[model samples]
Target chain A: MAGSDCLAANDWICGEYVRSRSQELTDATLQHLWITGASVAIGLLLAFPLALVARRWRPAAGPVLGFTTVLYTVPSLAMYSLLLPVFGVSAAVVVTGLVLYSLTILVRNILAGLEAVPEDAREAARGMGYGPLRLLFGVELPLALPAVMAGLRIATVSAVSLTTVGAIVGYGGLGNLIYEGMNSLFKAQVLTASAICVVLAIAADLLLLGVQRLLTPWTRGRTNARAARRIRIRARKAAV
Target chain B: MGAVSGAWTWLATGAHWAGGDGVWHRLGEHLYLTVVCLAISCAIALPLGLLLGHLGRGGALAINISNAGRAVPTFAVLVLLVLSPLGRYGQWPTIIALVLFAIPPLLTNAYVGMREVDRDVVESARGMGMTGGQLLARVELPLAFPLIMTGVRTAAVQVVATATLAALPGGGGLGRLITAGFNRYDTAQVVAGALLVAVLALLVEGAFVALSRLTDPLRHRRRARRQSVNSRGLPKRWVTE
Candidate 1:
């Protein structure tokens, strides 16, 4: 039943479409990557300072967290619309909206990471004459790497997902193809574009997870060491 | 400022709130789609999550599934479904896509919540000759209630937001207003449509927050105890426990 004219047959998995439109797919994928990267990177930069400010001041914490949470509650479509007046109908609107959405996850994760740094670590660093900045960067940040990395992974994946919403404004990378394909009922284009988007998000998540493991080597050993200690304790108890 | 005022004027117009293609109709459609999708998602996710969690099996698989689900864009799913054989079925593509989108949060939270219930509590319940079903319904369900509510809230809010995409496929919803506005180059109508969606989402979130507080078993127990104590004319100090 398979035909030589897959594209004309409206087949969902046509290699002909891929071969014919490889350059277009590449452009869309690159745009998607660029948008996701810029939005997430900007989000992290903004979230770090906001997290620091929230951590430093007792009262500011509530409003800072609350505002970001409110932003997150706003629908993606509404968020872009709200930003549209300021940024006009451009990629800037999408990027700004994404940055706002990422703030809630990023700020909360960063703050949690900072708070989880043991009080004794801070005390010990102070005793060793470490400055506040040095302690924050050297001791606390290293300890908080896992949580921060987790946040980064989440934000990046979500950004990749959300970047599709940008297609509404004609700026969505692969999303452009998906939207156009949907309009014309182009089965191959819709399926291929969506598959690529899914792959992009998964790849980004896996890459970030690998980076987290590499950067937080201590986290890997900590779990193993704890498990080993537990086994040794059980053995000792049995022997006695 | 002019655009803001323009949107305000568009919202204030009585004509925009009526008719077959009006704000009210679209709102109703959006809410209906959201509710149906959420109900379907809950029905599927909760039982599966509870069973897996109770059995202490396949939890990692469920969580991983959810994480992968999150990576799939709801918009792409919608478009893909509409382009497929499912397109002719009328609303099935949208409903199925939405259900898929809403399932991840519900399943993840339910599974995680069930797993997080105190192991000691479960063991003690079992010691008391509780059957598996009884243990799950009475002991585990109460403990996991808060987390399950959190999942529901997340799913509900997300479904509401994403349901707006239904309009893109010529389905009726508030998103239609936005799309229609875009076609007409009416910035005010687009903004108005966006505002309605955002407000509806926030309202859904608030409603769930209030609902969870009202229905929380732990909170209900505390309130019941206080009410009984007051009815018995006990001293206030004795109510501390």
Candidate 2:
């Protein structure tokens, strides 16, 4: 039955398909990458300080996180449409909405990472006459790198998918290919575009994983036990 | 300012509330799509995740599948299927796309939830002469309930938000409102549609929170009661409030 439709529909998946669509593919891929990158970058920039504030004032955590939750809960297409009156069909609208989407995860991860830093480490730093600022930058943030990287990986991958939804507004990366292909019933176009998007997402995730491994040498096999111990400590602290 | 008021007025008008294409009808379609997609995805992901987590194998595979799935945008999947033979039928393409979208969070969260249950607790349960099924039922599930619920909430919220895409294939939903507004060049109607979706998402979130509270057999964990016992008599009862 499926074959009946693709066959009768006059949509061919062939060599010429790849040749003719090269430029469109390249442009779409770039747009997708750029849009996804910008969302993650902006989300991280905003989430860092916001997370720190929530970390400092326990009371503000609920309201601040609640606001991000509301923002995130807005449907993707609706979020795009919600901003239509402001930015029209521009990439800014998608990026802005996605940044808001990314915040909930980013802020939560940043908060978790900061909290993961052992209290004893902080106390020891303080005992060594380190100021709050010094302790944060030199001690806590370094130890928190693995968790932060995990957040980055998640945000980037989700951004890739979210950017595709922006196609309804005419800026969705390879989404344009699928949209155009479906309209014309072009099987090759749809298949190729989906494959590429999948590749891009996996590549990005693996790249981030490598980066995480590189940055957090302590997370490697030798120092892995130390990391586990620190995690246990953080868990115990959370329980109390 | 103008857009907000215009949208409010547009929503207030009675014409938008009646007929097959009315807001109420579209809302039914939207809810139907969300619930169906969520139910199917959960059915597929929950058991597999729980089983793998219980056995402590295949976690990396499930997680990687979810992570890789992030790249296969639901829109692309929907349109591709819709263009193909499988899409020739009723709402299968739309349903399939939505199912794929819902799977990652549900699978990942459920898997992680199972794995994250305390090892010591499991050992203690085993030491107490409990069988695997008993340990899983009495100890593992209760401990994993919150995370599993969190995953369900994530999938449900996502399904609710993304169901707007079903309008593209002329399937049906609040998405019809959004696309129809765009086609008619009515920004106010578009704003109204988006607002309704946002409100709906929030409502779904609230419903899930309430659902979890009601069904969490392991927890009646206090939102209000934090008892601080003293060495002295009666523990000097006082509310954190």
Candidate 3:
């Protein structure tokens, strides 16, 4: 119960640990963020082309989707281990695994988004003399923003969670702290590190949500109109 | 390739598959943990999802809570639980963490599936004087079966993957093989352990897919419709996380 003895007592929530190890915590958190960001970015890059290929060739869609789904089914530990031989004991192992795991969600969403573009919209773009590349970039992708962003958010959060598994290779960021803390039974370090991971995931999700809202103004407009119509209908019923 | 061959040799060793710390024992532990955690998650999540979904209320709250739950890493939860008083209770900490990890997909998918049941169908069933229970069991549940099964598949696979973490905390599972391998710097052992976990996860996923297809109440009708629609290739929505 001594104020300064929280560390000695191995309390679950010791401020002393955080105060003393602020630099270590910060470094871990930054690494976590960096890994999550890099993986999601690379996933998007790879998924975009694959999604495009799947969209362009009906015959290829089944295999592309099937392969990614299979990749996703591999356990994270196994994923890293499988890549370990190639990437060795480095951050690349974690990043490669995460990128592979992310493909299932990213590719599905991207393809879904592209497919959802109203046929008439594409027709109009075509009529306007837009080339295939121009049509995809100018009209189809913009319309597909919401679904793509949704995928990004999910993939980002998943990456954050999966990144901790990278701790097995000493590249798990905060996961390393949690792993070490758990092994030594260091209550404060485990709790604090875990809490930070939860926070990072939530913050990343919120940031992506904000980005989605900003990028897809038309989606917001449609929702607003739907809400306004509901309100108006309720008011008419009240009068009756 | 050498590493893979090494792993293959490790797996092929008859000695490694016997005794206390052998592959069979670890696999049993892994399956036990996966099954127990999944059963607990389904029991807790499915009924709540069904009730809320049937009422057409509070589903958003349930789904949001589960979604938020997804943000918390399973490893962190496992470590924290094991470090707490629950640690003294043996596998309780691991079970608790895994059950928590498995619930979100089950809950969300169930709720969404039930809610997605056609409103007109529900109204028609109500008009036919089917009681609430009858309607839920006969109509709504059948319609929602695929989504619910999808959730189960998702949760099952996730639980299998995560149960590996239990071995890190001195609990029992195939994860122990990986952690032990790491300690000894035996790359082949780690690879072998990883291969086992991956195979188990894939097998669980495949089992659920087969089970869902076989047991689907509307399988005949669905197959007929699918055949007619086969010219268009797979549906865009076929892939889900």
Candidate 4:
């Protein structure tokens, strides 16, 4: 069986698996970046404006959000199928689906962040002679940045994972490597693809975490201090 | 399968399915595949999660393991597993891969839910002459139920969506229609598949939302006004009501 063979053939790449396809890996990574990068950019562009409009008019928020949630549930493969006739099996369909998938998280979070702006802050802003646009840009947006960032983080991770599925439609990505590896029973290739994916996922997660901490300075310090205080209190109680 | 057959029959001769035979047959298989995979996943994950949660040891490691599980692509895993002596393909490999896919969310939520309950509540229960078992059964379990339900809802939607991959390996389902639509460049069949999946997701989400309300009495009163209006065919009034 290939499972046992994969384990026994410690020198997997050296044996029949010595397929020097490094170019394929590089091409796949580039395709993945473009696909994900474009999707997130498009999602943010649409979601931010809609989120702003929805916040100013409370009635619009719920329906817009509900529509996006349904869009989120629409499967990637199905989305491709739906778009195939008009767009054909190109990168356009893949990116469009990814963008649609990003909306639910981005919109929901943006709305949540805006709403979380304490009413008193807005009142204070108005008292200070700030206009609606200025109040949102200066006060509400900054306060909501953490939540918005959190949503973006979730969207980014989701996009990365979903991009793998896009490879099935002849769009090259790390997933193509995995698919090829599996088909040929090439352990090294499969492992290589999976490792790159894991590293990418972790690197993205840690990068987002760092960005979140940096942007939400007050939140980071307070949370870390609170955690430290809890640990200290528990340690003292245990010692007593 | 029903969707595919409908698309196929429509392609052959744009005709209505007679006696609903094709629809029921296709729906039955799709539902069967979904149910079996979910059941298998729950069987493995539920108790494992509960045990790990109650112990509160290895929390980070368990979560990280599940996170890695989440990171692995389900379809890729299927392809890999299928290549082995598990050389068997189709629904079985799909089921196995989906089960693995579902475990992380289920375990993570279950663990976090029970672990994050108010320590003071546990202490109070203990002081009131309750054993750990009693405390868990009456307090911890009830409190964690909502969070666990969220995980279940997430897993259910994910399973239904991913189970379509079974069609890739020769098993039949609505995904077959979608995949076939892609291969043959048939737009309507693809639309049919996408629409069905979207509808299925909404229905499941609605069902779970109702179930969550029924299980939690506190939410019942707050959600009742909305549910009653919905049942009365007045979705417009439901949110405001």
DockQ metric for all predictions: 0.74, 0.68, 0.76, 0.44
RMSD to the true structure for each prediction, in A, is 4.3, 6.2, 4.4, 6.9
Compute the lDDT of residue B51 as modeled in candidate 1.
Answer: 93
Q: Which sequence of candidate numbers ranks them by DockQ, best first?
A: 3, 1, 2, 4
Give the residue spans of candidate 3 off by over 4 A.
A1-3, A232-240, B225-241
Which 10 residues in a row give candidate 1 chain B its minimum summed lDDT? B232-241
Writing each residue's lDDT as its tens digit, candidate 4 over B1-241 gives 4545554555454342222323334456667877887788778877777768877876996577665765566656666566555656445676777788877778888888889776766676688788878877876777678777877877777787777665554456567766666667666666666666667767877787789768873354335545664443322322353
Judged by DockQ, which candidate is best? 3
Candidates in order, TM-scores: namely 0.93, 0.87, 0.95, 0.82
Residues forming the 10-long window of minimal summed lDDT in candidate 4 chain B: B14-23
lDDT of 4: 0.72
Error of 4 at B123 (Å): 3.1
Off by over 4 Å in 2: A1-12, A127-129, A221-240, B221-241
- Could you give the DockQ of candidate 1? 0.74
Point out where model 4 deviates above 4 Å.
A1-19, A118-130, A179-191, A235-240, B1-26, B61-70, B89-91, B116-118, B217-241
lDDT (10s digit) by residue, model 3, range A1-240? 364599998898898899989999999999999999999999999999999989889999999999999889998888888788787899999999999988899999999999999999999999999999999999999999999998998899889988988999999999999988988999999989988998898999999999988888888889999999999999999999
Q: Of the true interface contacts, what fraction does each candidate have?
A: 0.74, 0.92, 0.73, 0.44
Model 3: chain B TM-score relative to the native chain B: 0.92
lDDT of 2 by residue, B162-212 (tens): 688777656788989988998899999999998998899889999998898
Model 3 chain B poorest ten-residue lDDT run: B232-241
